[model samples]
Target: MTLQSDQKEFRSWLGTCRFSKPADNGETVFGSQAVPTECKAVVAIWADSEEQYLNVLSLRMERYGYGIIQVDDIMPAPAWMVLKARNRTGPVLARQVSAEFPFALDLIENNPISQDDNVGDDKTLKVIVTTTLHRVEPLDAQFGVFPRKTLPEALTEWFFGPATPNIFANRADTGNTDDNPSRLYAVLDAGKIPNLGELLSSSGLEYQCLFNGKTASELAEVAPYLVKLEDNNSFTRQLFSRGKEPWFLWDRAGGIFIRTAATLTELRKHLRKFTRINRGKNDWVYFRFWDGPVLNALLRGMKSKPSHVATFTQCPKTLTFITIDPLTDTANRFIIDQKRLAGAKKQPVTPAALIDTVQLETETQVSTEKRLIIEAHREALFTAPGPDDASMELLKNEIPFLKTCGISKTQYLHDVLVFLIRNDLTGGKLSPEQRDILMHKRNNAPTKIRQLEKTVSA
Candidate 1:
């Protein structure tokens, strides 16, 4: 049995570029003609663009009944699975195998990972800045290295000519690659954009166009929009201190790279007042807040073009609602809505509503009172049979000796004791001698009422 089990586990190989579906019975995989006998698991690594990698990993885990866990920089040995090969025309064998993370490369690097610095202080601003550059006209372009100090020559030309000299100089000044500046517009979406006008004016940075390629001046135009603070915990401290928000670190199949998402500070501030926030294991973030008030305010905002307005004279107290959306899908559509205190003001909309509100009283107290009365009646039935003449008749009937011993029935009270004495001497079984001795014992028995009472009490 053990050998057969080993063969079953080791029958298939590690999947490479493709995956196989589970069998019709949904117990295990069936198509293994293409699988190698010695393989157990497959591993793959992707570049920094995580969008494609995340989808592939999620699919493989679901199809193979395997779990997804983080692995280290150094990958596993590719050829370590040959011990499970099966013997043909023989009993089956199964072997157990699993994925592993070796100790050497599994440890995370020591380089500092940035975290949020915002706390009780709310004045700091963090912004997602997007800049749009337009050319006076079109021109040809080429890539060349520029000196670090030159106004435009030192800057890397993102787009070639066919653009106006003024606009080309502006795009070159900031190292911007997009020729169509209208397509790239920046906004203060999540973080604080503190005193935007001041930052732009103080640095003399031109939002329209810059003749001199000044990276610092352009950053100054963008800086007021970013959350400002002096803490080391700030995520953009290195970016802010070095004056390089627009520098390209590297390039991949997609394009140039920079970190420009909503800062953790902005996200927390937006979601803090919400009643619930769900961070699911599938890498999604959802929020639920008081919806009734927000919806009415939104309606008012729609009605008034340039200013805030009121949609209703007074707010209702009963209705409450919330929403949920995934983090990756930022287009703001809710996956679920939980409503509380719903339709409280409606007047019997359905028959079921009326039934739910009906009140009924309990009958337990009344039933308990009737049970006690029945018990009292049962006690009255046993009171009539007193222990006197009836008791004397019953004793004589059971013993049968007093009537034959020539004792009067009135004297049965005395004869009862005499019967008891003879029965005890015969060990509760009557003998011929005990019957003859009964008369002798009867004369010796207690005769007076007071003496019989004393003997009975003893």
Candidate 2:
């Protein structure tokens, strides 16, 4: 299908979306819009590293409103085709899984150009990513697909800060172990429920059981119903709901898995995690947790979870060479708070209130300069709205040419005098001779104005 069709189908599958109001009755201040749950299918990839793949997976999954659960000893397949397979009978169908990415090359090439553009396009550059998904044996426990070079370290650092590389790297190293030690896997929510049993059973391969629980075998029974290969390059994971229900897809032994109480909640939870891969800050890994059963399932299922070492240290150290603006400073402060909440080592938290106060004081100094400019303009107005006879009564009734010029402030008074002399305005205000002199200076400036002023005054 075309992008339009894809989007349309996606929205239908996603269900009616809803957003939370500001400061809604939730622990978190910002409200979130609900993501559609009825995924058509899910895509998975066997990327090179969990860290790098997370970023990539986050992009793809987030696009379709999917989430990711870290699976131990299981690597996610790259590019699970979320859409239906067009024609399985075709010979090409045997080699690849899904349709080739529409603009893979154009996308990759245009990335740098977009980044340098600095306008809105530059922001897209950060969001667009390359993920390496693998078409590998289902039973094999050791494999990764994301190309290392595709991981843009500099770009990640620039957009997310220092911690991002390590977070990516850390995620990459997640699934590996001693024997079948390193299993790499991540899941995508297609937002449409598909026949998981038919998809898996038709793959012509035995389901690889990776999770360990009382219902492990029973869970495997439904694995096929929950997943499908759209083509060689992609596969989809699906879960449909009757009403409020919980759906789970996890490793058979004990590894990364995701479960949602409600189909919609599951999809939203998965999408939240899925899209978060690219949400890494300038240098740190900061992920928000999904409330409810998804969180409980992850805590219960995973044998071991990832840590945030890279996250804590990713912050930019006090710089001797660089200066941070308020925006960057706000981010830094937020990172500090996030790390603290994540149970990382504590750091000095510069209260935002303090920062606000400092900013206010500094702004006052800047505002003073502006005030002076306004005052100077006001003084200049005295020339146009001439001084009243009440003040001019002392000096001759002649208007001061400098004041009459309507240039405000004492500074411009000197400039106007010189301006008059430069034009050979040698006549004084009262005498025609002086008036002529003044007129001479009026049409001249710099040299003649200064010289004539001196000659007349002498």
Candidate 3:
């Protein structure tokens, strides 16, 4: 394509551009024969601005599978007057050109220039213009709003002007692409006695309670707003449905949802007391019991005319719970011992020091049996013959017991060589030939194992 200074023209040569459309049976039909004349153009322009260029390019490439036109070469206007004239009018012409045209620019800044060309008095600029028509496929009717620029007409009027247009003057704003905020829900349970409302107010923990006597079906209506606490366990559901005892619910970080049949009275009496006693302490206490049966026992104990009395107590330093396990058919008791900071203090160690201590402990804890097995393998490999057929056969036979004991061939060979060199098994008695063979086998064990695998697979 050719663009010049004096005249408002751009010329382009498009050779054999391919176009495709899906047939009724979903097969793609290509070339000028399948497309209409008006739908086709010698040079197609898809965008004028960068945003438009990106939108059009994305649509053509991703949606319609169309390839953008690529420029082969750019030639500058020869004379200084011609260069100035073309630069003045190039940007205006560029906006009118279709993106499918090799010479089209999303913005005038995209116009090509010859690096060797100069506007100085000593150097002359040279312009080359080529225009050719190849098969033209119809442009999609959906994209007809964009105008097409004739390559020859755009290129011919070129003698004297500027080379590139100033692009920032007419730039369009593209807004920020931040994502929308996510919806959040609070967990709650239906309750009555020591009511959820009264409990929430007393406990000072943030919570939202659903209405009492709300059925599972009614709860389902607000499912999106209700964060669930129970998984496969249906005890909480039963308490919400049948029991008059108050139930509590709360959302915990890391997706831990809490639901219990313990009343605000029992919660304040037991769980909350634990939190309060440990408050401001450098240590914390955690429960080591199941929830379902414990809550069942507590609720059963709280009945107005209860058959069995469930006694609960919390010490300033400890909390205890006694309950029955229906699955095991036995009574269980658990204690939450208070944890407190020690009065004695010591200097804190750096991470490097901690790592060194751990590594030393690990090294000291290596099993004696493992050490003996490695030593045995090392002695066998060190004393074995050279790489002769008979020697290899004998060496292989020596490791059958080791293999059955779960040592890998490569690991066995590696341990054998390492132990031999360490003077742990061979006591540094290895001859030059034995030492060389053992080292060679250890180094090449991986390759040897691969060959063995291939042989076994074959």
Error of 1 at 259 (Å): 9.2
Per-model RMSD to reference: 37.4, 29.7, 33.8
Give the per-residue lDDT of model 2 (tens digit) for 71-147. 22112221222212332222222232222421010010111122343342111111111222222111111138433
Candidates in descending lDDT order: 3, 2, 1
lDDT of 3 at 19: 23
For all candidates in order, the CA lDDT equals 0.24, 0.26, 0.28
- Per model, state how many residue pairs clash: 26, 118, 35
- lDDT value for model 1: 0.24
In the range 1-458, model 3's lDDT, one tens digit per residue, is 22234233433212112222222323222222223211222222332222233233334433333322222112221221232343444334334444244333222222122344323321111111111111111112222533432111221111011211111111122121111101111233232122333433454343432222453346433211123222222322222221223231211001111222233333333332222112123343322112323233332322211111111222222222323221112222222211110111212222221123243334322222333333444454563212333433434443443344344555555454344334422333445544444445344544433544343355
| Weakest lDDT window of 10 consecutive positions for candidate 2 | 318-327
Number of the predicted model whose lDDT against the real structure is largest: 3
Model 1, 221-244: lDDT tens digits are: 332121321122222121112222
- Give the residue spans of candidate 3 off by over 4 A: 1-341, 346-355, 358-425, 428-430, 441-443, 446-458
Which of candidates 1 and 3 is the stronger one according to lDDT?
Answer: 3
